[model samples]
Target: MGRAGRKTVLFDEDKPHNRVTQESHGFITQDGVKPSDFKKRARTDVQKYPSVSIKEKRVEIIEKSGGVFRIQTKEGKELYGSM
Candidate 1:
């Protein structure tokens, strides 16, 4: 989507849930990779595109109305997306 100039917003909470438990596995070529490492790589790749934006804020609510998806962040910011 980024290569095609489509807007992409990735919301990551950066929680350490995996660190407190076990290493993440089951994906092809990504086995044994730490959760933080995986996210870092993904974010780095996505950042190559100017149209893609990553937010560290958590989403508080999501609703669909008038053919658009509305997302409210914990910071009280509202964002809209169309399918």
Candidate 2:
């Protein structure tokens, strides 16, 4: 963010709380809001930035030993990550 995002960080939010209702002591403004609602709002806010790409899929394999990691996607998309 200091000088534009140079790399991507694949964040894992697999269990993004399928069912929950309200949080009252953490975030600002949205105090006592539904968890799902808060996630929706958070995702929306994050997605507003062009650099972020949200992928809703299970991470099958994550081998980080070599200089790069070869990630195999469920949809068969092989992504290489610098290690």
What are the Cα lDDT values of the candidates?
A: 0.85, 0.64
lDDT of 2: 0.64
Q: Which stretches of candidate 1 lie over 4 Å from their true place?
A: none
Q: By lDDT, who's the top model here?
A: 1
Give me candidate 2's TM-score against the actual structure: 0.58
**lDDT digits (tens) for residues 1-83 of candidate 2:** 31264444454546754355446447778777877777777777776666666777666776776698877667766777672
Residue pairs clashing in model 2 are 22-34
Task: Please provide the root mean square deviation of candidate 2 (C-alpha atoms, Å).
Answer: 3.7
Q: Model 1 TM-score?
A: 0.85
Clashing pairs in 1: none
Question: What does each candidate score in C-alpha RMSD?
Answer: 1.6, 3.7
Clashes of each: 0, 1
- The superposed Cα distance between candidate 1 and the true structure at residue 64, in angstroms, equals 1.0
